[model samples]
Target: MEKFPRERIRNFCIIAHVDHGKTTLSDRLLQMTGTVAENKMKEQILDSMDLERERGITIKAHPVTMIYYFPEEKEHYQLNLIDTPGHVDFSYEVSRSLSACEGALLVIDATQGIQAQTVSNAFLAEKHRLVLIPVINKIDLPTANLTLVKKQLEDSLAIPADEAIATSAKEGIGIDQIFKAIIQKIPPPPSFPDQILRALIFDSVYDPYKGVILYVRMFSGKVKKGDKILLLSSNKTYEVKEVGVFCPKMVPEEALYEGNSGYIIANIKNTAEIKIGDTLTWETGGTTTALPGFQEISPMVFSGIYPLNSSEFEKLKNAIQKLQINDPAITISPESSVALGSGFRCGFLGLLHMEIVQQRLSREYGVDIITTYPSVIYKVSLRSGKTIEVDNPAKLPDPSYIDHIAEPYVKSYLIVPSENIGEVMQLISEKRGSCESTESLGHDKVIMHCYFPLNEILVDFNDKLKSITHGYGSMDYTPDEYRISDLVKLDILVNGEPIEALSCIVHSSKAESRGRSIIHKLKERIPRHLFKIALQAAVGGKILAREDIGAIGKNVTAKCYGGDITRKRKLLEKQKEGKKRMKTFGKVDIPQDAFLEILKTDTKQS
Candidate 1:
């Protein structure tokens, strides 16, 4: 009902490693401010998705506006809290949230101290010039070591040990202290109301009733209902049907000014009309200058997603398009597999991202789908002097036409306990990683820097790191460069026919081993039938590995048991001849489970 001065606004985000209390802290903050009623309070109020709540992780970045009363100053301040995803897969989400805020609450688990993501996110916040408020969360646990964690924050992130706020978000302890620190420390957004209208679209969601709703942060101007707005990137104009702020839910407001974060609805019919980093301004501003958008996120993993029933293809496409309205990071293209029918070649940020997308497609859309093994994009230089990018093995060109292949590389950073350094180093080495440098972090921990092929670590590197370190290791990575390497496309053939869905591009040095493992797994998965099946792994035209599946046992000789040996031999010959004919005409029924199993196997092996 009352508008606060620009100086009384505090825009901030809570960021941390997975399961480090970001959502919990956000929930407590909402409770303290009474934005959410005590009886209505729930765990992870910002994580409205069932998947996020079930998994206890934040998948999407959520923004909420709360009013906090400052007794000392006798004033009310508008506090905007943007909660971000903690997993490395959603780092880009964290970056976008930071861009909308002036400060961030860097939460750390007191029991675990500083993890890899904590440091990585801290650097991102610093890059955006955000005021970092260090907070050690989960202090009520018996294992919480306040002194050690403070030291770790100081030694690792270079934050002042005394400046870190210690709080228990679950028990509502020290929440008032966090509020006071935010009001006194984090500065308000810069006031630029007189300037041309400019607002950043940080997030969006698709509503069946309202179409597309955009969550934005005003940086230079104000917006109101019934005003015409222009999307600078797309050069599209729409009448603002409504403008409001998120009080955990959209509440209509008369107008939204600079230094505020809220939503805008313009009757957008499709998500393709707007982009996450696009700028919005007054339709007649006559200025083409756009605000700085976020860096485009490139997908790190690729797979083929196909519906179980071919008739559901249209529904699958529509569902994916709707999902992309909210999550634009996923990349999709048309693809067809002889064994799996029509499908889309999809790209994702990471394994978790790939899994989440699959889960959402099945759970939210009620579509049963099959996914192929995940792979990374490869840069292929042909002898004809043209460089092409390939994400699917089926699209790989002939080996004779290829000059060389270059794969993506990443600068990987890992933090592990000193006792597990040897095991971690060995694991990296096995993944074809080259150590760049190593630094000691206190007496019991070490930080390692390495360069690894994107494909090599795309599958099970993180799982292996955790297993070897007994769950004490964390990792973060950034794309470094692309380097030329010896690569080959390994194809799987069943009954002398190659299955494009099972084909994969692998490094030449490990081609034989990987091919053998694939063929062996395929043999176990292909069921026994009336005809024997021959499974082969080939590179180009050369067979690298092979496996044979024997035909199902039958009682062909039962009728000739009392007869002479000649009669039995005749029956056997006839049965063998029949099997040969069946082998030529019969097709192998590859179950959907087989495709999923192969992908899971690759994760376990690679």
Candidate 2:
């Protein structure tokens, strides 16, 4: 248990786009530094979630401390490297992780060059004032064009091309260069150990035995096992149970000093008691001044998450609350649906984030849930000039009572190969988005500056963009100003009963097409019943799309094949009468999957 001086420590993280080999680069660092033993090593060692590993995308931020011997100086330095997610949905995770570091490694694929998140992450690192070292990864690929990529580094990212380091993370090449760059380029944390305690809680996780394990960055001062610490956000004090550092795993440390990024357990029982961006100080003599916390992220996507079993509502609630502790970026509130029973209206950064939360609930908490159609928070102005925000289409006021609806839009950065720009532009028009400007980068890739309604791209925009570009396209977006649109409420009816859960807000121009797709998808999922079930999508009492689920029919004439025709007619009329009565009283047995099917967005058209 040794404490290192702030001068010999460097805190850094890797930032890049999806599939840019960030995790692989991180793996190389751990291997080169010998932080992880050869026998214990695995691919994407930092990505702990099964989903992350399966999808080959980092879902959560991971931190580890590595001891590197600088042969030139003949001294060991402690490098705290936090691996972050590359997807745009996890941008918030990247931002919070950056707040704890003094530098970052901006990894770009040499084969693919600079993509969407490379720019977004670089912007984030600059905002945190972190020194960025650009690393061009995957140089061993046959398609690797280091020359073109270097030029892109200067043109698109404005970074000097010579500053970029070329390496193939998969082949374990140039590992020492990254370490040398980190030590020679990145500066030590600016901290005052003699001053009163000031640490920022950037992230945390819940443990059944330890309660809450807080991941922290010590800005100044020091903390020990027996020290009493106060969290400024909660205004509560607790005795530190233990202190440790992430050596890929929890390695107990005697004391955490200034510039150290580590963990603290204070026996805090509830996650609500400890805020992610809260500041920590000594319980008695600490200064009241709090470190600048992270910006509160507003969810760009909203959906309802309901458990399959109604009585398990509490179980789902508890599960979501626990998850919220780990990921505070998600917005949660109690919401009930007439068709789906009780559930929570959850808000997420994007569709991927929402999907992750739903999967976690099912896998981690073992809760089978249904997710409603995703929507964006819209600004609705009533005829009386009173404006309100609506996240759910069912909550939207009637068309007669509303004056105009403003939908959220994003300034999107879409980069694609030159040949696919035309198709990409056409796709943009299909989604009700416009290309504000186009800038050609290097020789082949073009960056399209587009403004798209946030809701228009929620479902499968990224997927479609990738398909059209043959997987060379990438997009990153930030919320832009809300604009008034010709919008309407599209509601679905099941056997003459309005299903609130299947309703969504849509642009009036696309309502008919969207409705037709939804009902068709629903028809595929809805099971045959004894009585005919009608599925309709309507707005203002006018049906825009209709699909029928035929009843499970029995051949009334089959049994009377050899009998008289009059007898067959009597049997057929009786059967028809029974069907009419059943249709009046019988309910459609819609599967949980059908709800998702009805809300399944047709991304191609959207």
Candidate 3:
């Protein structure tokens, strides 16, 4: 195989809002380039994970190299296409993907003019100084508004409406036009073969047989088999076992050069040794400076995950480690719950990310686990003039020990139909959000900016926003400074014994109502036993609400029909004494489903 000139390599990625036809456009591009055979073509070829396909969302960013034969130029160009996730949770992934490219394909749905994320990701591409090629997708739909969408692209993004390519990715219409535009509009990557080897590790995955495989883009020099390489971040050296490019799949190559994207295998046994955004260079080379890496990603939502059965704890641990190899954004720490036993307090970028991780553990690793309700980190200021960050409700200090508690906040950006402005504002207001600003995008679209507690919007804000806006709303948020708030820890007790796993941090204003709802739900789920079970919700040892599951009735009077009333009363008294003793010494066995149900319940509804 011959190495293509660096000037012929066009490295770019597709970025857009969720359900904006990014993956579909990628599939059409692959087909036009003959990279994938027609018979083997499938929907969302870049989305390899089953969860991504089933959920109709891209959870991970994927890269593939294609050979496009430009008929006009009568030459073949090497095109590298990176598909990125559209959700805000994976915005970090989008930023890293942009670093490896010189251009980006900004796809937008024709029916949905300009979404919050489309604007957010467009600014991200501009931040990376990548060339942006606007593509209006789904043009074949009945409700497609090409004129309005084109105007939106021009007004919001400052991209010329004429430059935007109209396409129907589903029907393969205007695909050839898109291909032509790519050749003319997108610039090629710069070559730096004279410099020492410096490859940026954008992504990686662990394989049981091959160990850790790194997906990287070479910005300088070359890497080949048998070459000794050093990970600059870790200062670790290893011999390169193989180097290859992904033609939709890993294909071994003799070497990878500048302006190329490919994979590198160095016989890495432990995933911890390889870090995303780390620089890879030749061990003996003179590359003194490393590439500017990505910013550290902090988790926005946290929950405790435990194995359903205590014996499967090791399996759960191993499964999480394996999953972490592919997804480094998750943060996990060991935690022990008095009621749920051993578990890990896991942190995720958002609720979707949390759900995906849980589903993957169950589907891929067959690990049945229970997860607690999610919470955001809080800063608690103590009377001693010291402040501590608390991520778990069980770790919250007593009310008397703290001066004030601060919770994370976000600057939320929302775009919705103008007619639904009232509904959207009401929804945000209900979540403790305050209007920061509002702007009119056009005749039909309105942009609203609000400041909201991060915990308030982490769970169902998006769902409610869409519900009120008739699925025409889009939102993006960035973390703001933490502010002092009236936060308290709500604890649940079963049979008068506190269950650490069922505790949650909530606003003091809603503690009473939330507590009542929790106890009520527990009463319906808990089973009746020989002894009555008491479920109570308390805050700082003051019980706010309680519920009781009546004990199973046993007839003591049936055998004493001919006896005196006093004899019956004496038998009842003896039974009451036994019940009292059982309530004091007997342990209540809380079912796993009960814990799961509590976590799954929407706190707002509760």
Candidate 4:
């Protein structure tokens, strides 16, 4: 493949808030460049995952190279656009994409103006020292307030309003302006061709025939076929088998050069060895000074994942390993439960990430799995002066052996209309959070910076915020320090045996109410057996709540015609004794629907 000059190659990405039409604008760019034929075009062309297309969201960063013919300049240029996800849950994806590019197109929904992620992504781009071009999209909508959006751009983001490009990506309007702006405003990729090979592994996928195929953005040098490359993170070496660029599809190139965005295929059978944020340098005489901004990601939420059928345990494990190749953000370790059998206790960035993994397992791998209740990591200070992190409630140490338990906190940034500030404040207070400060954004929108427990906002907090603000509010959060709290483990018991999968850590004040809600839902779902069943919720040795299910009695005296009263009494006494024996040995089968209901209690009732 003939290489384009580094000065004419621009590597940039699109960053925006959720539902802001970033993907649509990407489609427009691809169309305008004639990268995809008009007949072959489709919505969200880069969203290769069926799950992403069905959810109408991008879960991965997609990089593609397009050739633009400049009529005025009378030359062709390479435009490598990395399309990224806008959801805050996938901010890691956005940040990693930003690292591989020199410029970002900050797309904003004109109807909604500046959102939480809009500001959040803008800050992230600035942190990377990249040039940002603010693009106001959805201009053709009747509800789009271009004036208000431009004002927010100036007030919230401090970007000049006149510099913003107004576009309707859906109608293909103003695409030429955006196209021209890329060449005129955004700078080209920086090249260091004389340096040793240093390609950032922004993403990777598992290909059965080719082993692990890596998607990398070249930083300092070049790598060709058969060149020995080492993974700086793992200190392992492999020979490069192939090199190519994404023309929306893999087109074999002579070599991936400096400042180029492309893939490197190698004999990497073990996908785990390739870390996403790691740098790839020449195996020999490699520089120790690795690329900046690459750090290990720690998951914020943890949950137990078990195959619904125990026979699929190995299959589930294999599926998880393959999924991990795509989503390295998730952490997993072997775990077992008496009730659910062998499984993995996996950690995730958030609830949405957890849900996506579960869905992908079912969709992609055909694995039927059951996911237990989700949890956040807790800091436990032992009485012996040793500190341990507990991400699962079942693994929590006995209360007698603890000095104090501290829960993780988050500094949340919320943006909402001024009129909804009172209700939003009340909602935060309900979750045991305190407001730190508030600043006015533009004219009517207010940004509230507050602090709350990580567990408090783990589930339905954002959903509630959207509901309270009539779908106009947005939120972004960062992990804060852990603080001491009166937290306790809430255990659910059937008869006398505790169910580990149903247990969770809860604040002391909410323990009793939470226990009652679980028992109430259990009673409605549980069926009467031959023996009396007792549903109980306990904290330590104290029973906080209970529900009873009476046994299914048989009519013992119906067949005895004109039987004496003592005879009936004797029969009833015998039945009571049998029930007593059965109660001692009976096992209650908790249906899958019941577990789902208990999770609903924890997620919604909280």
Candidate 5:
């Protein structure tokens, strides 16, 4: 296939919610543009990750360059395709991908219309100054309503409704129109200076056999094989081993220059030497200024990740370090967990990001992890006029030790069909969420943006939301600010010792019920050991709930049966002979399962 001319080169990303036909549209575009043979095209062609394919959700941002031939002018245009993730947790990855594009194909499900994620994604694109081309996808469905979807986009986003393209990517209907719209509506990337070799590193991945592959967008200068470049973010230099442009199937070696797009690979000993948002310049005298947005991402979601087997701590650390080299968003630090043993305190952007990290650890690294309850970092002030940050529930200061505690909250946007608005409101209200405003998206759709306590929705919120909406409503939320609320730290004592696994925080109102449930569940799951176990939930020295393990008489009395009858009798006599081994209903050792059961209890009862 012949490469298109430079003037027609367009770099754009496809943004949409999960199952909004973003990938299907991409396949159609590639097919119509003659970039791939019709027979070779498959579902989610751009979601090259095995996990992404299995889950049918785009996680990593995938980039592909295609050639679209225009019949009207006998022209072949170069199209750099960027496929971005749809989950809110991966929004950081989406933001990085948006920076590399000049425009975006905003996809909307015709029947479903604008979703919560769709609005947030479009806002991100607009923030980055990317031209938005609204496309109503999945037009082949019987329930697809293009007119309604168009009006929603126009009224809500202030875009032209008539300009929207109705496309059925599965059947390849109106795909050509979308492609034509891309060339007409999405302008070519603005030309940059060719004097310097400055490229923005959007993302990087490690290929064991191929070393590290860096995804970059060059703003100026040219890159070729054997060129020595310096990574501005890391301050480490590398000798470029190979330069190649993406061809969908294989990365063919090609010379990419200014106003063009592609990725480059340089063999280096340490993959950590490269980072996202870094600038690549010639080692000797290529460029002096570094690219912007080089700050490392701070993790908002925190959790204790430990190996199920204590001996795997070293292996777990190495696996996490290696994963971080590719995933810069994941931050790791040494953590000593009382219940889970030695582990690492890892940070992530959100829930989905956390899930992806844990999944990758188990699947990619072949490590068994014992993950603790996910928690948000809390800022606490002490009476001594000092402040401390706490992530572990066990580290929570005693009531006397803490002056005040602040928790993080978020401004959440929820998009639901008009019929489900009532249900949506009720669910949010229960979470201490207050409605900020409500606006209609055309007729049958309403967008509700509200302020909600982050902790309220941190657990099982996604599942509960889907169930309430009948899988129709979608949500997107961003951390807003820390707010002071009436919060109490609840502790669970096992045999008079507080185990980290049973520590939790509950609103003062629900403390009794939540604490009771946690104690009951822990008692049921924890196996009986030699000693009786005492499960107690307390708040500020006040016991709220209690449960106990049954004791054995014969097993306890065996110690007195043998051993110099007189000495054994003398030893037992001090405790009234067999009375020391008498059957006590509340005596049994707490097993590992006891701690794990605490996580499964209903700790959010109100």
Candidate 6:
């Protein structure tokens, strides 16, 4: 194997929709570059995370560097590959991955043409000023249509689409051409002064065995093993204990200099010490240029997370704090949830991020948790003349004390086959989404862009869209401005006690129907307690929806059963003890499933 000169290094990421062969193409790239043995290759190998491989999705951004030799000119090039999440919910993670790349490999499913996510990600690449190298993948699929995709790329992106290569990444067909296209389209690393040692920390992860592995793309100077470095983002300094380039597996090299991309392991005791988007420079600061667009990430989705066992609450908090070090997009704060007890209010980019956090908690920390329904930030103006930000439902101001509210909106894109176009439009309209424009991409595929309230789809909208389209339509969205619309905040009460945290605002017309359905669902999932429970949904202190869950009967004929009636009574006592564990939402006894099941509901009137 040969290493390309540092000057030939090209740091880029492959962006695409799920199952669009982003991972497969990444594996083929590694093979073409001789980073991984052909026979030893696995599917989605770059998705090294156990959770990601099991889910058949790339949940985290994975970094790898390979040496590819263009056979035509016999020129060797070093490629730094960042494989990013394709799901729309992880778009923020994708943005962070994009920051590390000067170019992008936009993968389009040849059979599917351009899906919603692919076009959205390509636009994101353009926003980052990344040189886009379009690659049509899965050519071997029976429905593959390379010619139309070429035309779509040309018409939609207006990029030169003359020489689009078709590939079956799984079969390694046209893999070399894809590599050649990358080298031809993506520019070589820029020259920087050797006077200063500086690099950008694009991503970081905690490894119990390796400590903190920071993914870095070097811009100037040279970094050697055992060098003391300063993390500009946190002003923390550490000695680099190990350094290596990612070659499917870490391949330790002698050194990395300007224009090379690799990972460095500092002998830091805590993984939480490393922050993504941090800059690495010499401890003895000499010169520096602030990297562009290194803003701190703010989570967009918020929820309450409590341990299934109250005693583990503190442990969950500590675990979250540790995880937040590597996961900048996740935010945690102390919160008292009526339905979840005293837990942490966690914020994430989207639902996928929330799921990743929950999975990590159980798998990595061995902690089981009861999570509240995910919510987005709500801007509230109190009557006291102070503006407040609420991420948890419990923090919502009382309807009597509230002045006005605003919720975030998102610009969404829905791509569907022409046959399902009507169904897609109908679904969007039902979600209060306004069509922005529609474009026909030849064939039967159409791209529809709409402006939708974030609150409308934050729950259940994704599943409903998939269900309606019969899995043919896919969508991606980016946060837009907060919009003030006619809305009413509905509060949930259990046994005449208001659970402020379970409150949510819905458009007035849908409030009654939604409130009734949600309350009914909650009742079905929640177990009966010793006392009868009343579930009420209130707007402006007036109840719009109500339900009652009958209490468990205490009296059982002790002598009616077997000889061990004492044991049976003891078992009933245990059942009563379990009832005490059920969380209360106002007067309702909510079982564990009530929180998660709410996210899967669809209000399409089907």
lDDT of 3 by residue, 1-606 (tens): 469987788899999999999999999898888889899988998899999999999998899999988999999999998899999889988988998998999999998888999988998899889889899999999999999988887777789999988999999988888878777888887766567898999988888899999999999888999999999889999999999998798999999988899999999998788878888998895476778847767898999999999999999999998899888888899999887899999999988899999999999999999998899999999999999999999999888898999999998789999999888878887788898888877689987888999988877889888888889888998789999988889988898788888788888888888898888888877789999998898999799998889999998778886857999999999999999999899888878787788778736573
The list of candidate 3 runs beyond 4 A from truth reads: 191-194, 530-532, 551-557, 561-566
Best by TM-score: 4
* Per-residue lDDT of model 4, residues 203-300, tens digit only: 88888899898999988777899999999889899999999998798899889987889999989987789888899999897767778886567899
Off by over 4 Å in 4: 600-603
Score every model by TM-score.
0.95, 0.92, 0.95, 0.96, 0.91, 0.87
lDDT (Cα, tens digit) per residue for candidate 2, span 324-441:
9778788899998888999999999998999999889999999988888888999999999899999998899988999999999898899999999879988999898999898899
What lDDT tens digits, residue by residue, belong to model 5 across residues 423-522?
8888888788899999998777789989987777877777778888889888998779988777788877776677676676656776788788888888
What's the TM for model 6?
0.87
The regions of model 1 sitting more than 4 angstroms off are 552-582
Q: What TM-score number comes out for model 1?
A: 0.95
| Candidate 3's TM-score | 0.95
All predictions: root-mean-square deviation over Cα? Answer: 2.2, 2.9, 1.9, 1.7, 3.8, 6.3
Clashing pairs in 1: none
Question: By lDDT, highest first, what's the ranking?
Answer: 4, 2, 3, 1, 5, 6
Residue 443 of model 1, lDDT score: 71
Task: List ranges where model 2 is wrong by over 4 Å.
Answer: 309-318, 523-534, 547-584, 591-593, 600-606
Output the better candidate (4/6) by TM-score.
4
Q: Candidate 6, residues 317-433: lDDT per residue as tens digits? A: 878887886676787778776566788888888888888899999999988887765678878887888878877666666678888888899998888778887877787888888
Off by over 4 Å in 5: 1-6, 37-40, 292-296, 528-532, 553-588, 600-606
